[model samples]
Structures are given as C-alpha cells and as structure tokens.
Target: MSIQMEDCLLSYKTALMAVGAAAAYYIIRWFLWQLTVGDYDRKYVFVTGCDSGFGKLLAKRLDSLGFHVFAGCLTEKGVTDLQTGSSGRFKAILLDVTKSEDIAMAVKIVKENIPPGTGLWSLVNNAGISGPLGFPDCFTRKHYEQVLDVNMYGVIDMTNAFLPLLREANGRIINVASVLGRISIRTCIPYTISKHAVEAYSDGLRRSLRSQKVSVHILEPGLFKTELFNLDLIMKNIYKDFDAAPAETQEYYGRKCLKDFTWVVKLMGFASSQFHKVVNSHVHAITAKYPKYRYLVGYDAHCYFWPLMYLPEWISDFCLDIEFVPPAGAQKKKNN
Candidate 1:
C-alpha cells in the first residue's frame, strides 16, 4: 500500500510541476510581449490613401495625438486637402500607389526627413481601389490586371521598399484587408482575390519579421460610407461605358439588367454607414501595447460576415445566393 501511495504521489507531483512550468512560461511571454509593443507618443506613422475614407481619418487622428504623420495621396487635390486640413503635423506626399518610382521617392523622403536615431514607427498600407463590380464573367483580363496591380502588387512593392525603415524602428505594418478576403461574394471577384492575396502576404511578412521584433497586422473592414461607392460617380461611369458597349450588348441584357445593377448599388449605399469603427480599430491596432494579429472592424464585418468565414464553402455559397437573389415576384418578363 505504501509503494502504491508513493507512486501516486510521484505522479501528482509531476503533474503539478508541469502546470507550474506552463504558468511560468506564459507569464514571461506575456511580460515580454507587453514590453516590446508598449506606448506610441512621438513615433512616426506613414499612411497611404490619405485622400479620403479610413486612411484620411486615421492620419488625422494619429496626427492630432502628436504622432508624426506622413500622408501619401495620389492626386494634387488630395495633397492640398491633407495639407490644409491637418495643419503642419501631417506631411502630404503625392504617391501614386501603382507607380514604382513614386514608392521609391516616398521611401527616400522618409529616410531624409527622420533624424539619424528616430525611425518609422508604423507603416499603414491603406491605399486600395474598388474596381468595376459585376459578374466575374463580365470582367475582362484588363480589369483583373488593373485591380491586382493596385491592390496586391502595390502593397508588396511598398513593403519591400520601406522594410528597412520599418525594421529600424521595430515598427508595426498594418494592411487594410477586407472581410471579402475571408468570404468571397458573387461580384467583386477581382477585389476579393486581391484582398485574399494581401492576407497571405501579410501573414508571411509577420512570420518573417517575428525575429526582428516587427509586428504585422491585417485590418478587415466591412462596408462603409466611402466615396468608393459614390452613386453619382458610379452612375456616370455606368452610363459612359454602357454607351460604348457593343450595340447588341444592350439589346440582350436590356434595361432590366441596368435596373438590377442600380438596385444593388442602392442597397450597398443604404447598408453602408458613416461610423468610424474601421478607423478606430486601425488606431487601436497601431497604438496598442499588445496589438492583435487580425482586427475585424465595423458591425457587419464582425457580426454578419466573419461568422460565415468558418462555414463550409458549399453552404456559404448557398447562403450568399439566397441573400442576393431578387424577390420571387420580381423576375424579368420575357419579351414577345
């Protein structure tokens, strides 16, 4: 009986030791993580797409909080707006996201601007384009090429060019990927594909930078009230392009297709809101002591869309089809 008791005691002690070791390991890890990423007062942040939307708002917010903000815009008008709106705290640079020379110039400017010791604290890849939305079949090769060039290649080029500055500061890199990256929709195939590629690239970058103490974060935002979906702009483009389509193209799809497209556009406009959920999440990720790997911003992003990310592909497709189908009584009438 004594021998059995000794054996039992030994097993209990071993289990206790294991638990204690695990607890100690976690405590040390948490402490180190906290120490590595804490505080951001006077750090420099470089952000792209500062002309409008989340990028513009985040740049303004960070600048107001005393961070040196380098705002990259594509147009002269955007540069003017950022310069006039943000006082002297934010420096606006004309950066065409698709241009390699522009990205190189931006990196050069950053290297020259910061003093010898100070380094880039955060590099936010927020510049993106929402390409022409329709059935995937409708998109030409040129459309896919254009979208990928702006969304995926542009991000890779910028990151590769500015990696030195990011490493010097042990900075965090934030890429604005969308929920569409996780869950693909019927339309917006090119945009969706580009976002998925961004997620993969960001993940690889995070792994690569782990040893260097540089963190990478991906921001997945839901639909928001941005100029990307401006009704006037969309209508203008649609009419301009519709007129240029082959004469038979309009005869087949007819006015009904146009109406259906318009309805979809209006639905998107209604669903989108002006809330700053995405920008707020961006700020938190950039400024937090312990930044999370992925941030799902906006109500629909976290609530409606992200949950579907775990569903089976077939099931998810069926659900999406049901959600997007026109009403039962609204079917198009056959022409006699």
Candidate 2:
C-alpha cells in the first residue's frame, strides 16, 4: 500500500478502537449507576409547577420513590389534582412564583410539613411558558414581560425564597432550560432570551454556592410533546397575533410569510413524545451520588444543539441555512 493509504488504514483502526472503548465504558457505567440510590425517605423535595408536564410527572415519580414531596401549583384546581395523586408524605401548596407573598406562604407551609430534623433536599424549577409566537415586531412589551415573569424571574424568585432551606441541608436545585437556550433561533425571541438567562443564572449559582455545597443543575431538553409545544394552541396564538397587527403591518409581513413561519413548528413533529426521558434524568439528578451539571434530554439536544453551541457563528448558521426564509421576491410572489 502507498504511504497515504497506510496512514488512512491506521487512522480507521484507531477510530474503531476508540469507539469500542467508549461504548464499553458507558455500558459498564450505566449498570453501576443503577445500583446507586440516594436516601429518599429522609429527604424533602419541593417541585414547582406540578399542574402538568415535567413537574407533575417528576413529583409523582419522586413521591413513589418515598421522598417527602411538597408540590407547588398555581391554581386550586392544580393543587387538588396533584393532591389526589399523592397522600401522607405529600402536600400540595398554592404558589405563584411571580408573587413574593405566594412564595412566602409556600415557604411557611413547607416548613410546617417537612420532617422535623431534615431541611429541603432538592428543588425542581420546571414552570415555564413559551410566550407569544411571532416575530419581534409582532409582540408587545407585555408579551415579553408575561414570559420572563414566569420562565426567568419565576425560577430566580423561587430559588431565593428556598435558598435558606437548601443551605440547611446542602441541597440540589434543578432548573429546566431548553435546547433553545443553547442555540437562539429566529423564532420565539422572548422564550430564547429567558432560557439563556436561566442558563447563565444556574451556572453562576453553581459556582457561587460551591463552597456552601449547593449543587445547581440545568435540564436542557429539545422539542417534546407538551402544552408548551401543542400545535393547535400555538396555531391559535399565531393567528391572534396576526389578526391583531395593524392593516399596514399585515400587508408588509403578508399572509404567505405567516404561513411559512407557522409551518416551521411541524419540524418538531418528529420530536420525542415520550417524556419519560425527562423524568429519568430528573430522578438521577436528585438521587445520583454524582449528578451531571447539565442533563441534556432528547437526540436533537445532544446531537445537534450541544455541538452547534460550540461551533463558530458562521458554521452554526450554515447548518441552519436550509431553514432560512425565502428570498424577498419569492416571498412577495407567494404572497400575491
């Protein structure tokens, strides 16, 4: 064989050996982790936004595992619903994270219910909203405020309120960010901004509180089937924004442009609907002896967004080039 061919053959063999070693290491590690479970019965966990999605499922999962669960819900109905699923060691508290008074009330309730000797063991901040679905021009200040209040400020507000309890026990805080946090897309500016803030906040908190022994974590999941990604609901929201726009504004953006934008959501139709990945990840983060700093759920999260986040801006944009909007003339013609 020529020198070039020999070099290529050697490189291929080295790659194969590396892949085999990685596979073996991961397989063994998975089994080893399965044997490790934290002391659940003695731990108290507070989960926010337990009305639905990840919060509801995680609360139920943890409760089943024998952790004392204090679930926070926004409505009486949510509280009642969560209560029905759990009994004894579980108590549902009405909490609106945006309201300091409500958070204070929740703190009082949790303090009253927790086991006498143990402080809080874990807090899962899963409440979030995608906000208005349209271009930056299509939204108002209120639209941005509504999302940031819940998605960004809500987590910060709750963390501050619960830090004392966390410190008392050397606890863990799990913040649910998104793949969008890693890669800011053209769509949903407010949601992206809020998640990015969450990423920054969680990282800062993790380092700042390292000495205090508080392990902060982030959950960055790609598209999943949840109320946040409900198709009919999102379509209705887009229509409302479109109809509310001024006549001149509508003419400028055009109907075809709106349809083109709406169709982009279908890209997530293939996204994993099985939310168990989130539950499992959260469970490990809460129970594992050494949990990861960031638990990335879903293929798109690790395979696409994770690597894209490390790439140069030009390269990242190149990957997203296929999704780029049509040229001006083409869009105008389509509108006509």
Q: Which candidate achieves the best lDDT against the true structure? A: 2
- RMSD each, Å: 5.5, 4.0
Where model 2 places Cα greater than 4 Å from the true spot, the runs are 1-37, 246-248, 327-336
- lDDT by residue for model 1 (104-223), tens: 899988888787767899999999998767644456788789989988998999888888888888888999899998888875788899999999999999999999988999999888
Q: What TM-score quantifies how close candidate 1 is to the native fold? A: 0.81
lDDT of 2 by residue, 1-336 (tens): 899999999999999999999999999878766764567888999999888888889999999999999999888998899889585889888888899999899889888887665789999999898787776678888888999999999999999999999998899999999989888987788999999999999999999999999899999999888878777888899889878877666777777778878888667567788899998999989998778899899988888888989999999988875664653456777889
Model 2 clashing residue pairs (backbone) = none
Ten-residue segment with the worst summed lDDT in candidate 2? 321-330
Worst 10 residues of 1 by lDDT: 327-336
TM, every model:
0.81, 0.87
Q: Model 1 lDDT vs. the true structure?
A: 0.81
lDDT score at residue 188, model 1, on the 0-100 scale: 72
Stretches of candidate 1 exceeding 4 Å from the true structure: 1-41, 85-87, 236-258, 323-336
Give per-residue lDDT, candidate 2, residue 10: 99
The positional error of residue 207 in candidate 1, measured at the CA in angstroms, is 1.2
